[model samples]
Structure formats: structure tokens, C-alpha cells
Target: MSEPTAFLLAMLAIYTLPWLLWRAAGQRSWLPLVVVQIVGGVLAGPAVLGAVFPDAHGALFTPGVLGALGGIASWAVMLFVFVAGLELDLPDAWANRRDTATTAGLALIVPLLIGAATAALVMRDSVWMGVGAARWQFLLGVGLACAVTALPILLLFLERLGILRSPLGQRILRYASLDDLIVWALLAVILVDAEMLGRQAEFATLFALATIAARRLFARANERDRIPLALMWLLVVALGADWAGLHYMVGAFLAGSVLDSDWFGIPVIDEWRDRILTLLMPVFFLSTGLRTRWEMGGMDVIGVALALLAAIVVGKRFGVLLAARILGWAKGEARLIGWLLQTKALIMIIFANIMLDRGVISPTAFTALLLAAVLSTMLAMPMAQRAIAARDADKG
Candidate 1:
């Protein structure tokens, strides 16, 4: 329509250029892309460049856009969860069950407690919040903090650390798989409580119908059954949920968690899951950055910044460390493991969106928690890496 709309789109192109170049260069590290998504969105956002575009194409930044992006992101995430379930290879995890169980359990529980305590300390008064959360934000924040580390991030990081296939690696991956189960379950409860979902039975009934349909169709599936057919299954059920006023993510996640027992044995199923999750999932992460409001960078944000960031980083990292030590991991490994395990990602965005969808928190608070989340991620990846490397060097 005018020069500005095209110019804004051009800026988006420039921001995406490096990401495309990095992908071409074979980089598996995600930091660069993560940075681009946030920076690009910020540079083009209403808060920062609103004065520039004043009122760009109104539809570009509509609620519908966010909702659609979230749905797509949820699917990408569900694919990863399905792959996680496929990768669990329960027989192997069972062999290493003790360590897997211990680490996963500590990872989920510790951060929650720490988040609750942290929220209690600094969340007095409304602080100009808009999500309707006078106190519930902290409670929700604790759940978000403790139970919601990133499985996808850990998987990527584990491969880089040279520990993904080690004895320790097996434990970590399996532990992450188990932890995702907890995270998804916790997410369901929170979503239903906040009315992002209705009664749990809506999910249960939908799942049961899905189960019967799956058993009949995939009773004797092979790679042929794994591919386009499986993809169709996910799409159909997810769409059905939307038509029924149900959340698709819960359905998709349930589909993933309750994987067919022969999932790993069925090479085709495993292959499809891997390719889709690895490739398509980054779209979810990129959209997460898009949702962030970078205009939050100011004195107005500094107050909650301290409490939220400290709770997510210090409280989570140390609490997991303590639990691991109690579980008999050596102090060095426990600390390192704690750091490795707490890298935040999709869960934060997903849970926070759920809160916003249900009116549990304000848009301003969502922006604040999201800001805290970004700071935590910056702190987490490097810290976990260094801690893990130091422990390895000591062992060496």
C-alpha cells in the first residue's frame, strides 16, 4: 500500500539473511537463530518502530496471527515430543532407570519450589500488571519455572557436549524424556485450570476416541504406516480439537506421549518423527521470539527483572543441584547436571500463552515473565556448558 510496509518487510528480510546463511553453513547451535527472531521482531515491533510505521498493515500483528503461530508452534513442539517418546527406547532407559529417574525428578521438582519462594519475596502490589494476576502469577510462575526446562534445547546441547551417547548422555536424554512427560502433564493441569482447556474429560474422551481409531489403523504398521499417514493422523485430530473448542496441543501431546510400543522398531516412524521435529521445530522457537516485546528494555522493567531472573537461574540451578546430590550423584556431576538440565525454551512461551489465553495474567506481566525468561536463557546455556565442561575435565 505504501513505502513503509514494504520497508518493514525488507527489514525482516535483512534480519533473516544471517539465519539462512548459518543454516547453509551447517551450524547446529541455535543461539544465532534465537537472537535473530527476537531482535528482528523487536526492531520491527510497535513499541520500538511503531512511530516509524504508525499503523502498518493492521492484520500483520493481529491476535489471529499470534494464535495461528501458536498453533503451528504447538504442532512443531508436539512433533518433538513424539520423537522424544520414540527415542525413549524404554528398554534402554529402564536399564539406566535409576539415574534417569533421579535426574528427571530433581529437575522438575527443585525449580518449582525455588520459583515459589522467589515469587513470594518480590511480588507484592500490582506493579501495574495487566494479566489479572495479583498473586496467581507467582504460583503459575513457580510451576513454569520448576517443571518447564527445554527438552529440545537439552537434546541439541547434549549432542554438542559429546555426552549425548555417553553413559551420562543416555541418562540425561532419558531423564529429559521423563521430565517432558511431567512437564506435559503439568501443562495440561494448568491449561485446564486456566480454561485454555475445558474439563479434563474433554481431553480424555477425545483421546479415547483417538486411541480406538489409532489401534484399528496402525495395528500392524510399518514404515508405510509411519509417514504421511501418521502426519495425517496428527493434523486431523488437532483440527478436530479446534472445531470442538478444545486445544489441539493437549491432543497432539497426548498422541505423542502414548506412542505405539513398536515406534522405535518401526524405522519409518522413527525417521519421519526425527526429520519433522528437527527441521520444523525451529519455526516454533522463531515464533516465540516474534511474540516477545523488546520495548520492555527500560527502568520500568528493572524491578521484576531481579526477582524473576534470580529465581529462574539461581533458584532453579541450585535446587536441581541439591536434589541431584541427595540422589547420590557426586557433587561435581550434580552441579553440572543441574546447569545442563535447566536450559529454558518452548515451555515458557507455551505456558505463558496459556495463561494469557485464559486471562490468568496481564499482557504486561506476560511481557515481564517473557523478559525474565529471555534473560534466563542467556544465563543458562553458557553456564550449563561451562559447568559440564569443567566436570568433564576433572574426570579426565
Candidate 2:
């Protein structure tokens, strides 16, 4: 209750909270850690605790720390995308063309329809005017975010049910891989266009296109024999984005899609994933946990919460399911598409942090989105696990 005591407790939080998140993330589920951080931060600081003495404590996500965390997260993204590139079946590409087309269509079109409708009808008032998302662009961001399911999560879910190599599972994975790759392309073009039109950053899009061409040229010159140097080339693109005032993630994503073509072999990507996933990504996650704040953000932003849920659960998953059905998939395959496609993690938190920091959405909206994302991941995964398990059991 005393000023000095509250200050000490606040200081303790910065260190203690991250440690707990670090531990929670080690158990292979960092989603809950995001929730804990937000709750813990509010409990320790001025929003709740410092009400008695307004200036007694501190803020949770300071700008300097956020920037550092952003840099760290960019690395996690690079590692994540690199692995995504490897998961694609380059040799069997022709065999899965129908599967990829169906999955990509369902993933984007269905949820986009749901999100646009939801925004116009359900969240019409915009709760706090400037405090929440505005413009059709923001809605498009919501739709794109929902439409593109994380192939990584789908892969993990399939493996858990021991269906990674199953016929149906592999087909679904191929579609997921293709869709994810295409999603990155869509996202890159969006970001590039956003900068061009919104900010009138006249040189941004052209420079980005040039970077892609240049990286490719360099990559080709040395070929696969120069992966180490190519990685250095990739890092240049990443850091160059930071220096250029564009988000580094856009660069990393573009690189991944371009690299997703199986530049050399799967072994290279497999090794990269093993090192990055098992180590660096967790630290990046814990850092995100440390930044999330729940106190200032309340249930007032229910629209944002509902929007996140609709996108992840319906748009992303159901889209994949629709694709499979259109391709003459059986009921079980369709269900698996729906189930596996909904497993979202990592990127949800990452983008939540981005939108929040950029003022695209309020802290309240950010907070609500994070919570909804946490709940979405928790709810979807168990259902997916059971469905995949039951499907496999039936096969036996």
C-alpha cells in the first residue's frame, strides 16, 4: 500500500513476469503466457495499484523496450518463415494443384465475407471512434489476418495426432503450405501498397520490388552452395527494412515465400527450424508476454474480440474445409481441413503487438484481441486434436 513498497513491487514485476512466461512457454504453450503477462502487469502497476497515488508506479510496454522486442520478434519470424519454405512439396507440386487452389480460395474468401459483414453490422458504431480500427483498410487487415491460417500450427496439430504422413493429412498440409505462401505474397503487396498510398512513400514499393530482384540475383549467382551468404543477404533485407522505416516482418515474409520454392533442399530448412523454434522463438514470445497489458484494455472492445474469433475460427478453418469439399473431399477430410486450419499461434500475438504499437487499434482493442486469440487457440486445438485422433482411429 505504501509508495515505496508499490515501487519495489512494480520493479519486481518487470523481471518476475518475464521469468514466469519463460517457464510457461517452455511447456510448449506460450499462448497462456500472453494472458498471464497482461493480467500480471495490470495487477502490479498504476492502473489498478497506483490509483491511490497516481504517479507511484510505471508503464508496462515502454517504447524503447517495444522497439527492441520488435527487432527480436523479426528474427523469430525469419526463422519461422524459413521452415515454412521447407514444408512445401516442391517435387509433388503438380499432384496437389487442385488441393492448393481450393484451400487458398476457401481460406481467403469465406472469412473475408464474414469479417466485412461483421464489421458493418455487429461493430458498426466503432465503440470509441478513433480508439478502434477505422477505414476499409483496417477491415481488410482483419480479413487478411483471418484468411491466412498459420501452416505451422496446422503442421503441429497433424503431428500430434500422428497424421502428418497420412494421405488426407499430407494433402491438407500441401494446401496449407500453398495457401500460407500465397498469403505472404498478399500480405507483402498489401504492406507495400499501404506505404505507397497511405503514407505516400513514393519510393517504398519500387524499392521493395528491387530488393526482391536483387536478393534473387545474388541468390542465383552463388546458388545453394552459398546458403550462409544468402542468409546474410536475407538478414540485410530484414535489417534494411528496419532502417528504411518499414516493418521488418514484411521483408522476412517476402523472403520466406521467395525461398519457399525449395531453393536447395529440405535438410537446410529442417536444420534452421530445429535451432530457431527450440530456442529463439520462445524468448521472443516471452518478450511479447512482457509487453501485453490488460488493465487499460477492457470488455468495451467486444467488437475487436468478436472479430478475432470469427476470423480465426470461421474464416480460416471453414475456408479450408470448403476448399476440400469443392475438390470432392470426403466428410472426414473436410472436417480435418476445418480442424487443422484453425490452429493459430505466434503470429496473432505478433500482429496484435504491431497494430497496437502502430495505433491501428487501441490498447483496449489490442488487449481484447490478445485475449480472444488466446481463447481461440485454446478452444480450437483441443477440438482439432480430438477430431484428428478420431479420424486416425477410424482409419485403423
Candidate 3:
């Protein structure tokens, strides 16, 4: 088949197959469409499809086709990350500073410590560590991957649960917002290229100044013009960061972080985010799956995934439960919050993708992380719903 034909065929499959499977599965509440798409991506990847049917896989996922899909996926994720930054509510976090700090801190740190320890054990074999990574870098990367909460996906879950605008939802958002900022900051630190130190410094200085000016411009501009300006800024900053040896996604998050969500209105931002998730992010998921490797053996990858999931679930719950006891929160609140915070779907994948790009983690490590993320996310809704139900029954 011609390249164009192959590319079109691939696009059709990317868009349709996941949705079909999701529908076929009866769209269980515990298994969201996003999770299905992620699993679909893995199923379509080399370890599964390529191994099972190499000729068909090669025909559809040609280098030229993959390259084109990659470009789209890159832009799609940048847009998603930028939106995540824009949605952060720092003012509210400060208003509830003590509680937010205590909860977010423990929620983040516990998982991180557990994940790092797990990483140390996993890395003993050496096959899981990326070629360019130091021991510390690998450990830190894996730890942070475990701690990340996917803010956008969290929003979707909250909305689905009918509590997005409730006090509980807002509180959850605040904790996640704080975690998101710190996680990205640490990622930037990890990505700091020693050889490109000078360029990175220059980018930082210029970016700070540009951010001040952009905020002013955004504040002054009419609503209609703000979106276009934001998109331009996203492109410029993402390019600048990539050139500075920080990944473009880091730049993308920075691009949105400084801007106020109120500038474009929450409804507009919500609609935009939803559209991106619906139309573009599946390609990103597919691209992620294409990178999966199981050279260390499929069972080994599964074992690593399950181990990482255990660390995240246990660490998150223990930390949140600790915080709840200290703060005097009602019974069951900690369990619900813990499950929700441990939902690591897109953000963890994005985090691991960067580590993979920087060679801080191998393809085998990436595959494990990806699998863990999908499983953890699948567990969140059902577990959270049960916690909620149990809480309500006790109150009754």
C-alpha cells in the first residue's frame, strides 16, 4: 500500500478500534474510555501486534506514518499539558494552605519514597535503567512517576462522579494543583542538561521576562484574542525550551502556568480541553504504545507493573490516612482522597515519556510504568465510589 493509504488506514484504526472495544466492554464505570484507549495503544504496539503479526504491523506503522503521527501526538500532549497548567488554582490552595500543604506533601512524598525504593530493587538487574541515566536519576524519575496525579483526568472523573463543583472536588483540585507544579519543577531539574547549562539559563531568564509581558498582554486583550495569543505563546515557549535542552512539554506546562484560567473563562477552557481529549489525545496514546518493549520478557514487565502499582496504592493510602488522622477529617475521606490522588493515567505516561526521551529509563521501564498507570487509573473510580458509599452509609 502507498504511504498515504497506510497513514489513513492507521488513523481510522486509532480513532475507531478503542471506542469499539470500550463499547463492547459495556463501558464499565470502573473502566473509563481513556483507560480503554491506553490499553488499546499497548495492544496495537510492537510487543503485542508486532510480535503477533509483524507484516501487518510494519505495513500500517511505517516510519513515515509513525513520524507524522508523532508530530501530531507531540502537539496534542503539549496542548493538554498547557491546559493543565492553566487550570491550576493557586489562590485557593493558599487559602487552605496548611491543610493543602500537609496533605499534598505526605501524599506526594510517601509514594515517592516507596517508588524510589522499588526502583532501587528493580534496577539491580540493570536492564531497566536507561543508558544515559545515573542511579540517582533513574530512582528519582521512577519515584516522581509514581507520585504524579493526572489533573485533567481527575477533572473528568470528578465531573463524572457529579462532584466537580463541590467543595470536595475543589479541595482535591487544590492538592493536585500543588502536586502538579512541584512534579513538573522537579522534572525540569532532572532534565537539566549540563552541556546546555548556558542555553537553559538564557531560556529561563527570557521566559521569566516573557511571562510577565504575556500576562499583561493577556489581561489587556479581548477574550477573542486571548486564545490565539495563548496558542502562539505555547508554540514559542515550547520551541524555546526544546532548544534549551529542557523538553518541550516542560515549556508547554510553563506556557500555561503563568496565565489565569479566568482570562478565557472556565467554560471555554473546559470545552477546549474536552475537545482535545476527544479528538487528539488518542493519537498520543497510540504513539506511546508504539514505544513499549518486552525484551526482558512479558511476564517480567507485568511483574514490575504490579510491583509499582502496589507501591503507589499502599504509599498513597498510608500517607493520606496519616494526614487525615492529624487533620481530623471524617472517616473514609482519606480513603476516597487517596484513591483519587493515585489516579495517574495521562500525567504518569507523560512523565515516563519524558524520562524515556531523556534516557533516564529504558523502553522496558517505560512499558512497566505505562501498564501500572493504566491499572492504577482503572482502580481509582471503583475504589473511590466504594469509599464514598461506605462513608454515606455510616453517616445515615
Candidate 4:
């Protein structure tokens, strides 16, 4: 078949296979569509499909097809992350700065320390460090991956639990929003190039000026004009960030953060975000699957993932509980807060993808981190339900 036709078929299969599997299995409660999509991506990767049917894998995902898919995936993730930036209510976070800081700091720092320790151990095996990574870069990347709370995924889980706009829910959102900023800042630190420091500084200045201009324009724009202008702005900032040695994802987040969500209308932004996820993000998931590697062996990858999972669960809970103690929150608050913040599927996956791209982590390490994210996300709702239920029971 022709390349274009083959590419179309691949894309169709990429989108279809997950839905088919999700439905055929009776739409199992444990496996949400998002989880299914992620698993589908891994199953579609070289480690599985390529291993089982080399010729077919090669024929379907030729260089040209992969290249085209890469473009789609890039745009998809940028738009998704950009929407995340728009959703962040920094003012809310600022208003509750002390609580936000106490919780976010403990929640972030404890996992980072534990994760860094895990990275140190893993690096001794000398297999998971990326080719381009310095000792410090690999450690920090892994640490941050461990600490990440996938804000987008957390929102979905909260919505599922029927507490998305509740007082407790808003508190969690503020904590996650603060951590999201820290996540990207850490990413910038890890990605900074000594040689390009001057260039990066220049880019930051230019970006700041441009952000001011964009905010002015967006404020005056009517609802109809904001979106096209936003898209134009997204592309331009993303390009500039890429040129400056910061990743486009970083640029995308900055692009959205400076503008007021009120300017575009929350409902409109929500609709656009949902539409983007539906139409484009599956492509990104598939492309991500294509990048998974198992050179260190599948069982070994699973072992490392399990280890990381233990550290993440323990460190996150410990940190959160410590913070709760200091704040004198209600008895059951910390457990619920910890599990809710542990959601880490999409954003963590994106973070790992960037690390992998930059060679800060080996593909095997990336796979391990990816598995941990999926498993952590899967555990979030089930564990949280039980936790919240117990808390209510105790209160009653």
C-alpha cells in the first residue's frame, strides 16, 4: 500500500484499537478510557508489536509515517498543556499562600528527596541514564518525575468523584496548581544549557515583553477573536522556546499562563480543551507508545517501576501527613489529600517524554517511569474512594 494510505490505516487503528478493547471488555471500571489509551500506546510500541511482528511493525510505521505522526503529536501535547496553563488559578493559590506553600512544599520536596535516592541506586546499575545526561540531571529528572501530580488527570478523577468544585476539591486544585508551576520550573533548570545561558536569558526577556503585548491584545479581543489569536500566539511562543533551548511544552505553558482565563470564557476554554483531547491527544499517545523501549528487559522494567511506585506512595503520603500535622487539619485529611495528589498519568508522561527527548533518561528508565505513572493513576480513584468513604464514616 502507499505510504499515505498506510499512515491513515495506522492512525485509524491507533484510535480504534483502544475503544474496541475498552468496550469488548465490558468497559471495565478499573480501566477507564484514558488508562486504556495509555496501555494501548504501550502495547502498540516497538517493545511489544515490533518484537512480535517485526516486518509488520516496520511496514506500518515507516520513517515518513512516523515523521508525520510526530508533527501531530507535538501540536496535540502543546495544545493540551497550554489549556492546562489556562486553567491554573494562581490568584486562588496566592490567596491561600501559606496553606498552599506548606502542602505543596512538603508534597513536592519529600518525594523529590526519596526519588533522588532511588535514581542514585538505579544509576549504579548504569543502564537507565541517558546518553546526554550528567549525573545531576538524571537524578533531578527522576526525582521530579516521582513527585509530579498530573493536574489534568487529577481534575478528571475529581470530576468522577463528584467533588470537582467542592471546597475540598478546590483546596486540592490550589496545591496541584502550585506544584505544576514548580514542575515546569524544575524542568527548566534541568534543561538549561551552560553554553546557551545567554540565549536563554534573551529568550526569557523577549518572551516577557511578548507576553505583556499578548495580554493587552487578548484583553481587548472579543470571544470570537481570542481563539485564533491564541493559536497564533501558541505557535509563535512554542517556536521561540524551541529555538531558545527550552522545550516547546514549556513555552506553551507560559503562553497560556500569562493570559486571563476570564478573557476567553471558562466554558469556551473547557469546550476547546475537551475537543483537543478527543481529536488530537490519541495521536500523541500512539506516538509516545512508539517511543517505549525495553532494552533492559520487560521484567526488569517492571521491577524498577514497582520500586518507584513504593517510594512515590510512601514519600507523598509521608510528606502530606507531615504538612497536615503542622497545619492541624482534620484527622482524615492527609490520606485523601495525598492520594488525590498522587494522580500522575498525562502530565508526568509528558514530563518523562521531554526528559527522554533531551537524553536525560534512558528509554528503559522512561518506560519504568511511564509504568509507574499508569499504575499510580489507576490506584488513585479506587484508593481515594475508600479513603473518602472512611473519612465520611468517621465524621458521621
> Best to worst by TM-score, what's the order?
3, 4, 1, 2
| Candidate 1 backbone collisions, by pair | 111-146, 112-146, 130-362, 131-361, 131-362
- Can you write out model 3's per-residue Cα lDDT over 1-396, one digit (the tens) per residue? 989999999999999999999999998888888888888898999989999999999999999999999999999999999999999988889999999999999999999999999978865777899897788888999999999999999998899888899999999999899998999999998888789999999999999999999999999999889989999999999999999999999999999998999998999989989999999999999999899889774688899899999999998898899899999998888989999987899999999999999999989999999999999999999999998899899999
Q: In terms of TM-score, how similar is model 2 to the real structure?
A: 0.73
Candidate 1 local lDDT, 96-134, one digit each (tens)? 777767666766676677666655665544542335543
Write down the worst ten-residue block by lDDT for model 2: 125-134
Give me the runs in candidate 1 sitting further than 4 Å from their true place. Answer: 2-32, 51-97, 125-138, 193-199, 212-216, 236-246, 260-290, 294-302
TM-score, model 1 to reference:
0.77
What overall lDDT, based on C-alpha atoms, would model 4 receive against the true structure?
Answer: 0.88
Q: After superposition, how far is residue 99 of candidate 3 from its true place, in Å?
A: 1.0
Candidate 3 lDDT at 377 equals 94
lDDT of 2 by residue, 260-334 (tens): 345655666657765775545654554554454445545545556766686567776677666766777665666
Q: Candidate 3: where is the Cα deviation over 4 Å? A: none
Model 3: lDDT to the true structure: 0.92
lDDT digits (tens) for residues 212-265 of candidate 4: 889889988888898899999998998998888889998998888888889888
Top of the candidates by lDDT: 3
Q: TM-score: which candidate is best?
A: 3
TM-score of each: 0.77, 0.73, 0.99, 0.97
* Model 4, residue 18: C-alpha shift (Å): 0.6
Q: Roughly what TM-score does model 4 have, to 2 decimal places?
A: 0.97
Model 4 residue 54 lDDT score = 91
